[model samples]
Target: MKKLLVITCFLLAGMGFANAQQTSPVWPGCEDADDVKKCFNQKLSKHVQQNYVYPKNEAGEYVRGKVTISFQIDENGKVVVNSVEGAKPKVNQAAKEMILKIPEMEPGTLNGEPDARNFTVPFNF
Candidate 1:
């Protein structure tokens, strides 16, 4: 019983430590600015708007769909697409391409050390 209590305390303390140390990656130009997270999100939205092209079907009609894209900013500051959900294949491909074009950023940190972090965005057309 005493061992179990000690393990529980350790686990809770670890969770708090992890949460306290988590930090989001900063976009290229926002590295030194205040509000890094807001800057990162704004840049991300602008990037998608500038680069994402909704694919057209064989009939030459634009495919209207929403895609939820998941990607990771790796320790090297490169975007690595993990998955795309809820879109046609062409739309998914477009989403992936746009995400891949994200410029290298300063990777996120955990406990003051670089860490890979996942980000998700939804594209609606």
Candidate 2:
């Protein structure tokens, strides 16, 4: 279909541009920003509730765990998760699942073009 060809062309162009422009490595298994975000937000919504025992920042409790939610902003302005680093194994493990559930934003770019970039998120419970 015409759309597929258009997409392929864009992706190929993106690949070339990405290689030359990318400073940080983008996450694998994704073709676009939305896909990457879906991997984190929508896909893992249920998993977070079930697996992560951490309370939301909204809940004012005293726990000492930190999850650094890191992700990439790809050329198309999609927010993608690069990794989730945590202070504890439990936190990191829980975050890893939650990380995949986040939805990508419009990927970032350099010089008015989309480029793969990383972001950090912090969660405490």
- List TM-score per model, in order: 0.86, 0.41
Of candidate 2, the 10-residue stretch with the lowest lDDT total is 21-30
Candidate 1 TM-score versus the reference: 0.86
Q: Tell me the RMSD of model 2 versus the true structure.
A: 13.3
Candidate RMSDs in Å, in order, are: 2.2, 13.3
Error in Å for residue 124 of model 2 = 0.7
Instruction: Give candidate 1 regions above 4 Å deviation.
Output: 1-8, 15-20
Off by over 4 Å in 2: 1-64, 76-80
Residue 31 C-alpha lDDT in model 1: 74
Give me the overall lDDT of model 1: 0.87
lDDT of 2 at 84: 74
Model 2 agreement with the true structure over 5-119: per-residue lDDT tens digits: 9999999998887676423322444445555656545434454565566533336753458778776656764555677776676667667666555454445445556667666
